[model samples]
Target chain A: MYGIRHLHLRNPGSWSPFEELERLQASLERGGVALGGASAGPAIDVWNEGDGLRLRALVPGVKPEDLEITVEGDALTIRGTTAVAGPQSGDRWLLRERASAKFARTLQLPFAVEADAVKARVANGVLEMELPRSAAEKPRRIPIQTT
Target chain B: MNCEMKNGCATVAEPTVAKATPACDVWEGEDGVHVVAEMPGVDAAAVEITIERDVLSIRGKACLPRASSRAEGEMDAVATGYVRAFHLTDTADAGAIQASCKDGLVRLLVPRKQPAQRKIAVSTG
Candidate 1:
């Protein structure tokens, strides 16, 4: 059976529900805060394949040439910037909820991976990456000897 | 925190329902009104746009890849479905609406209908 698993590693130390609530309340009290400044990391999804892992990230408005990916040992890092269109002279922004800024995310793999075998592709603003396991990490069986 | 046993392994409780409202930007230009929606992980073929009367609805489903092995550790998962709707004004020409999806972004164009101008004749009595 094909199974899919996700690994979520968020900065727990810096985030709290109470703090988020307080910030929301403060923004409401101040009428409205200016958009931007806050850099929330993009959403990412990881899949644990038998011999490798797959990662998908949402990066709308980001060009393929702007993305940079690196894999070293068990750490995989992705960095990119989303272009923000300049406002036209006569145009007024009614709403601006989509985030636009330079963002970086690094994920720690559960096991070592083959850096050379990694492949990545971007389509429709989503980035997909495949990381293969190292030769030594493949499962092996040992035979018992009876004396 | 809630936990459940799935396939003999204890797993964190996951929200069964996916309720993701995609972010959107609406603006009017000299040509027409434009609506841009950000829907990540959604393919161009999976996007569905429908217009009924004055209501315009957009729906998209993301087909995330599957893994062969069970996953461990804690990770946040993105919603796979997106939905949003907008109301069109009387000046909007629904028949001329056009939509395009690219790089996980969907753009819709709604052209405005021009009102006919008439010159009234003035009679001097």
Candidate 2:
């Protein structure tokens, strides 16, 4: 889920009270998930678990040092830059299909992430993370007695 | 597997099952043609590259843990794996093909064939 329930679809003539904020959120989400359009950044898979979320993003050839991950509230942002490979300096390219750019994606999760418990690592051109839910955001089981 | 069916694969290509097509870049330079592909979740040990006749096949089984989830992009191959193959040109030399897989990325180089060399004898009449 993109957090917001109502969003003005891309109809040029449409406008609403939350239009400005929705537009900004939608644009930022373009990097996060493909809600209704093509994703500008890497493909991501987010699983909403009972306690937290598991996220995976494809980023081949991107080194760990080149990535920047930051979390604020329920939103998590992933940014990276890639270097295109070549046989030599003056090699002629026959086909260039891979993305070679500075890209960033921000995702809005359902619960606040425990920053200390979150562990992220890059392997085989993919970024994987486990975001544990904050204690305050976790649901507590209340005891009940027969009355 | 020097020769095969029209598809160039000695191993049977499963027509019923769909596989993930990896994103790749092909360039001609240095000794020959080089190809690079982005295949996340695939490891070096899991990558399979086969050359039969003029066909170069790349297949990798990518296994990732995801249970009861909502995802995006081509998720089918996450369980089934990735399948891709290339037909080599006549000028390419298959004998010296060099390939390496690292961190879910595969790079292949097909060197150009060396030209025939022969010395012509000159006679004085």
Candidate 3:
């Protein structure tokens, strides 16, 4: 391991031991609180696959009816919400860690994607969007005759 | 001492806010069990739904983006609230539960477990 001074320079965001412990405790406490107060969970991972770009989002509990996908040029916007179901009930719960509220995530594509040919599917709590490259944007090859 | 004794019960028994019971519609058919939740503003990514032993639990947060003044002039779409729940039920299949969100409605399909197969022997006639 590098010296403490060198390590601190390399990782500017590194906190002291006390600070780290405090942060850990804060996170645990936050998790124990009611759902809405905690931070957003995971972020979507996107990649470019030679011929096209594939975007995958981990949207676990949302229903098919509560999601909407919109693409404007290279920017994609996913908007939707899950409704709280059930009547008011009187009960006492020791702990509640799930968040119940609305949220939206938007992303700008790095490369130009064929907006018309894009396809999306949600299965097993994952949303996958496949965006193919436009004909004009795809790589072209030239064939030469043997001299 | 007298005031403490008189209000001890009152202090311990603070009136609790009546928690609202989430309204959902559940349907069971040969295909699977379908559950529809009416959450308005929650995002699909923020929602966590699980089915264990036939009990379905859905939890997620909703954060509506602040509308820009320019966009307000162009469009009139309003976002509402969030969606969270721990549904305790035996009607749904715990092993094969599928969920999706669209617009403001959440639809869940929990397929029942398949039955075991029995071996059948055929004798030459």
Candidate 4:
């Protein structure tokens, strides 16, 4: 949706050249749908944490109850609808710029995360999510045996 | 709606002090005029609304979260605040205005005053 406008392609060390091609292909497909002007979603900011990743999405005028978040594999999806009440039959509108529509955005995480450990909260129309890295993906120290 | 005088002087002073103007929508109906503005990341306590004569003003500061230690070079610091004002007309009843904020959206209702109707007496001559 509209939030993808701020997607920064940082050097995520894990992706291979072949995976990059697949990601480019998927982004092109998403661009095709986004160009239709169906839904201009909210703005989002993604940042890298030491042991995890954090995401913040701005969705004003949308109720928390209407949001649906799902994590599948390495992808995180957020779906929600903003509904504004229609004007009455006899009412004449002076201005009508506000829009109401359904939006869905999916982002591929750089590393595998603990699905159950993910934390999310909605405050002041901003959705904040913290995805902790999986145990297997965390760095560990290995001991060396002297000959 | 005549906002100018014969001397070519503007009656209302233009608002040029806002750092960032937020998106706003105004609707007119039988009840009166309703205004909705989007102010994401702003808390209700930080919002300020005032009405001086025919001018309605809105100002708020966005409470953005600080960057984590690991995101020193990855994130950019940008201003995400809003300030806006509107010149109202005589049709608006400034005294009866009401406002509320929820989900980072502020809604203002300004009720219109009803015009007084005069009764005329008729007699057969």
Candidate 5:
């Protein structure tokens, strides 16, 4: 048992209770109170894949019709509404972590984008987009010959 | 103070280990107690619910596309999941709790038990 535990300690990918606490602390420091404070933007992640750039946003309960995705030049913007009905006369709220508000966020991409070819979809409360690079933006190669 | 007020009362404190708490909204209403959690990558088939004693727990596993394998079986993408637990009061019919998931949202409903009323026969001496 001790040997296995020691092996886990050496594995960087393994999760530990201390690391979880540190992660929680780090998140709290990065504006934890912004959540549910009125009009907080949804969490978004954008990454560069080999074929194109991919972006995803966390917007649970947001109907697809309510989301508007736009890409201009190298900037991408997502706008949506998240609404959780308030408690009625006989309803008593215990926890209100989720909120009802309009959220909008824009992020700049690292390279030129082919806005016309961008594809976007929302599913299971998540929005995903595939952004291609413009043909003219691709790097041109030069060849040289020695006599 | 009604310490026994259980149905929709949140557990005393937020568990510090809520790595991805999956923003939740819990409420108690005439219909029942409802718990809605926002779990981005989770699907209807990926949710799990369990009950023990007075506690009810919800866990959802988000499914990500196969991570790009780097050198030596190293994965580039890590899955982040959502988990939370609640304490159910006697007023809730734990046996009849219903849960549903859509597009990445999980909603749970625990029906409330109406206060039982009884009539006692009068004894004439």
Candidate 6:
């Protein structure tokens, strides 16, 4: 129940929009939930709940002091860069496969999030962020008076 | 192959995972270089980090238990293994390499051999 809720699908010119949307919908339905296509960025997971929306991005090798999180209107953007200093003079390698560069991703929320209450934390290599729901968006209970 | 080094260093083989690629924090002090890599689902014994001269190599397999348990189903969010490698410089000391694994992270320390100091004798002709 506590997993990705939306996944954004792009046309990518290989498939029609209708076909893409249908596949996306089917995948979500088959999984017993949905994450709209607009949420799947590199190393990222997006979800929603009664509280509002949450986004988690896995960015290893990056320090918390190096990240930047920003929200404007319905869009949320995360950006950061990682750098590795050169090694010693005699180290040789057989195979090297790891990504290192600047990264940026933007996402749209299903409902308006209280931007003021959004929070982010980086542990290990995962970046977790939570956006609270607006006061007006929260559920309210009405009083019933017996006549 | 064109080895055009970028970022003020000689280029090695380019990495394949272009976007959102996993990286490691490398610290080079007077004695050694410390490398901390994020390798989720990988065990301490399973990982192997090697350095020869100036090239540093990292290779491992991350396996998820019960990954093949389900025979028939939608098979959503299946776990898979990962293998990554890197080429480093010769300054990394191969003899004092130390590594540790914690919470799916692998930390490696490669010490550098200090150059021996020698004095030259001057003969007056």
- Which candidate gets the maximum lDDT versus the true structure? 2
Q: What are the per-residue Cα lDDT tens digits for candidate 1 across A1-147?
A: 011111122223334669668856643442221234534446676777657888877787788998989998888878888775533667545445566677776677877889899999988788888889977787889899999
Off by over 4 Å in 1: A1-38, A136-147, B1-19, B68-75, B121-125
Q: Which 10-residue span in candidate 2 chain A carries the lowest summed lDDT?
A: A1-10
DockQ for candidate 3:
0.02
For B36-111, candidate 3 gives per-residue lDDT tens digits of: 6544445577566754442345644444333223321111122233323333334334666788876445677656
Among all windows of 10 consecutive residues in model 5 chain A, the one with the lowest summed lDDT is A1-10
Report the lDDT tens digits of candidate 4 across residue range B1-125: 22211221222232432234566666666787777777877788878888766567776677766555544322322337666566667677777888887787878877776666899989899
Steric clash pairs (candidate 2): A124-B103, A124-B104
Q: Runs in model 3 with CA error above 4 Å? A: A1-42, A84-88, A140-147, B1-125
Across residues B1-125, which tens digit of lDDT does each residue of candidate 6 receive?
11122221322233442111134555444455565666644567767665544455565454432322344222222223333334444444466678886545677765665657899999999
Question: Between the candidate structures 1 and 2, which one is better when assessed by TM-score?
Answer: 2
Model 2, span B6-116: residue lDDT tens: 422234345443356677777777677788878888888888888767567787877565757555322222434676666676677887888888867898877887878
TM-scores for all candidates: the values are: 0.72, 0.74, 0.39, 0.72, 0.74, 0.46
Q: Note the residue pairs that clash in candidate 4.
A: A2-A41
lDDT of 2: 0.69
Score residue A5 of candidate 3 by CA lDDT.
7
Model 5, B24-98: lDDT tens per residue? 777777678777888877888889888877677787887654325323221222336766666676777888889
Q: Please give the fraction of native interface contacts (Cα pairs under 8 Å between A and B) kept by each candidate.
A: 0.29, 0.35, 0.00, 0.28, 0.32, 0.02
lDDT tens per residue, model 4, A1-147: 000000111223333669668846754544222423446355666677768888787777888898888887678778888777646777655555668778777667777888899998888777888888888888899999999
The digit string of per-residue lDDT tens for model 6 on A35-138 reads 33222323555665446666656554567787888887567777776544344575432223344556666666656677789988775455767878777767
Q: Rate the local accuracy (lDDT) of all candidates.
A: 0.66, 0.69, 0.48, 0.65, 0.66, 0.51
